[model samples]
Target: MSANGGDSKVAVLVDCDNATPEILEFALRVVPQFGRVVLRRGYGNHTTLANRWQEALVRLAFTPCLQYQYAAGKNTSDIALALDAMEALFDERADTFCLVTSDSDFAYLCRKLRERGATVHIVGEAKSPDALRNASDQFFEWVPPTVKATSEQIPALIQKAEGSKKDDAKAVAKHRPLFVVEAVKLLAAETVEGKVQLGPLGTYLRRTYPSFSPKIYGHSGLMAMLNTYDRLTVEQVVKGSWLVSLSEASGK
Candidate 1:
């Protein structure tokens, strides 16, 4: 259970052959916003990817399920991952699932999981099939985190610090609470019948936009964050469940 009283538990499954390490890191960061990640597994040909993924897998504490490619062109890991996901779903280990893959083959799997009342989130690349991305409750495009500009990229930063102080403040000031509120308001188009469930909306915003942070805006959780926005309204239709609708944000 989270401090915010989140009851949902998430199972994170990664198809290592289909996504990069940076994306996997980003996925893990976003999953916590939805719920606790009870199980973490990465499927791939570990023997072949040892040099590239060993340190990362170990550092992230992800259990690597090795699936070797016996043939010239075959995705043995995909089958393994699908099987495990089905078993976990049937076992009711978690109500939320995150598939970190760009493979279209899992699109049908996403539909089946949703039919069983599980919220499926896909962390995929921009090139991932639209069907696969749309099949899930939420889709997140992986973006490599930006680092500080290097001396080679901006030589002037190292040479002159006097005038750069104002520029740095300007950059930092752009990430105000209003920016997140505006984003939430814009997402009204994505809602169903003009309503957005808090759980899924939180998952969508956090996964879709990695830079979004409730803490930065001085909120404890997604509901708390949305509570501050007058343009949105939140209601508890049932115990421990929330629904948000576009109020003045919709501009109706």
Candidate 2:
């Protein structure tokens, strides 16, 4: 913990088998959402694959953990990832852990981290295993292939809600009153089995909705505004940061 009582160090463990290269890129871009991804590693059976990811791994500067098949039905990658996570924990090199994979095998690892007071954030496909999602302090679902960005600008949505134009009728009808709805939609879409990282959600909102200034809405920042919305749920994960979701609001 820092002087501010914040967990700023992070370790990102990627299961190359269960995660897409594109989602990995998107996930890394949002690392600052929680803190810094100080230790980055990718675990897979790289020796045999000889695929695109092998070359991609070198370019991305990820420490590769090459696992060999021990038996016909065994996957050593999951065990390797878990071992590394524990090593990072014991070494005291990270205060928070980011697990990027859809494997439920990591559920135990996430629970273990939380037990030791380390913040765990999970990122995976929309249909990721539920046990893994529930184990993390926060989790994010990778965007689905079906979700496409609309042509309408975010500013237009805000303006239509605040303006008195009849043309605003369609925009108003099509959009939610607050940016939180868009935020929630994004969360819902990316949530792997209904899990989303509050930290990354906040980061994504800021990047995608820059004009959503909390000052304009008479709040200090985005988190405050999110808390005020009855449609949103916020959980304090580690001091200043929160795990946000719409499940509570939707009564799921």
Candidate 3:
């Protein structure tokens, strides 16, 4: 009872086999944006949950739904998760459901939940299939934090890459996504001063491209990634608040 005026109930179900425990925090943050998360559950086999996810589950206060494998090559965890989601839907325990997985098998489950008048959100990796992403009402691409470069080191890294013909420069350009540049310009045009807030910019990018992530471009976060490009201008209007706009050269 602590989000969106404590009215909407959100259920977050994680498929541990498909996603890692490190993404738990990111997934939880996404829940509050929609509503108060009432149910937090993680479904996995004995080995999957016990070995890697035990600490995260306890820290996040998530109920562990363990599924034993009776036969080889069978994912019983998926069945258990789907059953619980249906139960929650029928029992009116939650109006919104967030499935944290990249598996396309849950596409059917997402559609079923939506058919029953429930909002379905997906928090998964860049590898999530189009079927699964499209099934959910909103899809958030979970970009695992980069281990190579810290956020503080990004500005220096950006400076080092400028006008270089080395392999490193090619590597950076290879991961640079064009969709981000396009989104900033498109979103900026709708505003009075051609500036877009960080929150809405991120939401629009995630909604339009389910796999969009700054980590893919070797940046720690969105701001670091935006700073890599010269065609975009990022400014801090308030503490922890950012405004992004297209540069004069790139704007229409």
Best candidate, lDDT: 3
Give the runs in model 2 whose Cα sits over 4 Å from its true position.
1-7, 47-49, 144-146, 149-252
* C-alpha RMSD of each candidate structure in angstroms: 8.5, 11.2, 7.8
* Full ranking by TM-score: 3, 1, 2
lDDT (Cα, tens digit) per residue for candidate 3, span 185-208: 888889999999998998888666
Could you tell me which residue pairs clash in candidate 1?
A: none
Instruction: Report how far residue 149 has shifted in candidate 2, in Å.
Output: 6.1
Lowest lDDT 10-mer window, candidate 3?
A: 150-159
Per-residue accuracy of model 1 over 1-252 as CA lDDT, tens digit each: 345427887999988887777777778876887888888888989553585677777889899999988897888999998888888989988788999999999998898888888888888775787788778876766644454533112222222377775555344332335555555565656766666678777767755554344543434457776876777788888999887776865474
Better structure of 2 and 3 per TM-score? 3
Query: Candidate 2 overall Cα lDDT vs. reference?
Result: 0.68
lDDT of 1: 0.72
